[model samples]
Target chain A: MPRLRIQIRDLSKTFREGGREVPAVSRVSLDILDKEFVALVGPSGCGKSTILNMIGGLIAPSAGQMLIDGAPVRDVPRQVGYVFQKDTVFPWRTVTRNIALGLEYRGVTGPEQGRRVGEAIRLAGLAGFEEAFPATLSGGMRQRVALMRTLIVEPEILLMDEPFGALDTHTKLNLHAELLALWEAKHQTVVFVTHDLSEAITLADRIVVLTRRPGRVKMIHEVKLPRPRDVIKLRESDEYAQQYSQIWHVLGEEFAGHAV
Target chain B: MSEKLKINFWRLAILVVGVGAWEWLTGIKAVSKIPGLYFIDPFFISRPSKIVERFFYLNSDEVRLTLWQMLLSTVESTIIGFLVGVSTGFAAGLVLGRNDRLARIFEPYIIAFNSLPRIALVPLVTMIFGFGLLAKVVLAWLIVFFIVFFNTFQGARGVDPDLIHSARFLGATEGQIMRTVIIPSALAWTFASLTPSISFALIGVVIGEFIGGESGGGIGYLIIASLGTLNSADMMVALIVLAITGIVMALGIKQVEMRLLRWRPEYQQR
Candidate 1:
């Protein structure tokens, strides 16, 4: 097992809306290992993005502890990269410039920055799109640019918040394969938040299911599928069926919730 | 033969036909003096060729103070006003935009202040700053600032929450996000602000000329003196000058906007 150890204790977030405090994420706890592609599966508005934000150190946790690489984080640490659900490429720059922005921000010096940017563009399967503007690129390609923008910084962990929820299934599958291949090579600690169970199952080494509003972890299921399992073959595998049954059983109950 | 040339020829033809009708109507005594035409007067509301004669004399130092000097005065005031207004507006807007709480408290007050006709301030600025180039520049600045400030403020604040969330997730510091995300978003709007702002800035200098005078041969001064003496031909010449100046400034700003916003959605759509 890779030593990409992660620990979170009593994580919570609350926001004031319409003069009332609304809980977003409630006292959630999880410890994920190094190079563990953890899929946070939940219904929409279940605070999966909130959890990802906390991990990325974009938003401070209202209460609780989170440790990545055995260190407590107060803010965005250099060791983390984030891919947003929507395209956030700078509209003033070409796609190539957008991808190279992180290197520029981190003060990565010349020649090397260009080379790494070129490599990342290729890695994200954004070849021949280096000069195109974000507006000119298709939705899938723009998201690819967004992913490569994060990849250029070469962070140890990646926090992806439903990065493909906007793309159609066909585009999503292509990107999924690209992402899997990229991860196989880099082996960074990845925490992906998604409502789509198929996406979660296809990508995750371990899937952590969360309950509805004010989300709390309900179950964590591990995958025993072989390395680099073809995503298309997932539905056919009995192991896939077993995993789906396991996740679905946990989800259907929590989805019904401990309701009145 | 080409589409562009065909459009251009039609526009030119429209101008010629309109002027011809104006000349015939005024010659026939069918129009009023308030709106002069080509045949209105020999010395006062003279024909287009006569106004063009005055415009040609714009090249002479004695008759028109030379074309270069008129251009220099207008260019200097325009540049100073634009720089002061745009920079101040951008800085204020960017800073205030981040503090939504503070912005909300002050927004109504800012809007009210902008609503008060700014032309009223020309006299106030001339009194406070004195009737010099500073007064003109200040007048121009006042005219240009509010439009730019409001547009920039909205642009910066209206950044999609998702983008900021993404930036924060990607290890961007607040300062980095402002420089990278907030400013770029605001710039597209700021460039738009320049069109109206340039027009306002020109009017400011003209207003300053009305109050203090660009001393001599200024377009505003020429228009006023021509009106006072009822030299309608010279007034037409000054009006033409003013229109040309406005077009040049507007076109210049549009060029800059095009250069800056080459990646905007409109650019791709076009």
Candidate 2:
């Protein structure tokens, strides 16, 4: 196995709301290898987003440790990038300016900053809407801007929390294809949090199934599918069906426990 | 008709109808002497036509300085007060807002100062600053400062945590985040407080003039002089000018707001 790019050791998070302790995650240990796309799949309220937030150093893990590239993740490190479910693009900034924010904040100026922003915008298929504000853009287009905003910084690890959960199926599919194409080219380590099994199967190299609520890792499934596979075509295959049924079975057990 | 025209038409109608009714009831002596009818005497309320005529007359020369000169003096003080008040308040708010410990330490003092009857301090300010244009400007600044300070404090404190987190993850330092994220986010709130604060500045200047410089300085001075001799028409003329000034200032603020906040999406109700 490749040297682990990200290592989470018995990670957990608990929130205090209204003077009560609400446990969110429970002793979730995992290893994500370099250049691997790992999909974190679970039922709603399974702390999927919480894990991603912890990994991104947006929130501190209550009772565990996180190591990225053999170093402890103490704060929001420059090597880590996060894409939120909601559009985090500044409404006041135009597409080009918004995408350039990371580089700008890092003190990259002049022609080099412009070149990087331009390249990311082009990759995200947002070339013509460079000057458009977030308000003027469609939901899909705005999310693209959000993605480009993070991608332009050239982070080694990208942590996404249900990045396309709000999009329609057609838009979601298009983004999935676009993301996969980009990921295939760059081969950065990605940890994607999602509830959709199909989305997990479509993008991830290995799927990590998490149990509900005080979430813990239930199982890990390797894709076994070849690289450069077409998303639409892969779903039609027998392997995809078998993999889907198996993951759904494990997820249903968590749902059954949750229902009680 | 278009929305703008329709709104303008209604506004004009309201002004005409309201003033016409006032003119008929109080301005015309014949209307007041109608059998079995008691009406407000024109001497008390004054006629719109007489007020307008008095306004023109005063503009030419009713005192040592023309109405225009007095108006210019009042505007100067108000503008100075507004600029000084807004800048200081915004700076203080941003500093206090970013530092929770500092905000807590000074909260009581700020509240105490804000709660004190500011108008009552006019006499004290007049005594210290000598009833001049400086006194009026100081009073205007004092009144406007608290209003803007409170709004800006809230605005800076209320910046969305998500945005801050996003900015931090994108490699912004504390100083960079303050400039690029916090300040811009606070701008909408700062602007929201502007209109009321500006009006307060005008009120402060007028009150200062009314209390001290009653001879030949401002519209408030003219009003006081008119009231001394019970010249209701002259008083009304001064009031009309004040009203026009207020409306014009409000419109100017709205234009500035629109220009600065062009990025905000306009939401329409269906």
User: TM-score winner among the candidates?
Assistant: 2
lDDT per residue (tens digit) for residues B1-270 in model 2: 999999999999998999899888774455545753337677777888888888788888555677888788888888899889998999998889888999999999999998999998999998898777888999999988888888889989998887888888789999988988899888778888889888889999999889766542888888888889899998888888888887888788877877777667862111
- What's the interface RMS deviation of candidate 2? 0.9
**DockQ scores of all models, one per candidate:** 0.59, 0.75
Clashing pairs in 2: none
Overlapping backbone residue pairs in candidate 1 total 1
Give the distance in Å from residue B33's predicted Cα in candidate 2 to where it truly belongs: 11
DockQ score for candidate 1: 0.59
| Model 1 lDDT tens row, B96-121 | 88888889899899988899898988
Compute the TM-score of each model's chain A versus the native chain A and list the values.
0.93, 0.96
lDDT: which candidate is best?
2
Task: State the lDDT at A73 in candidate 2.
Answer: 80
- What is the lDDT, from 0 to 100, of the residue B11 in candidate 1? 100
lDDT of 1 by residue, A139-210 (tens): 998888889888877778888989999999999988888899889988989999998888888899999999
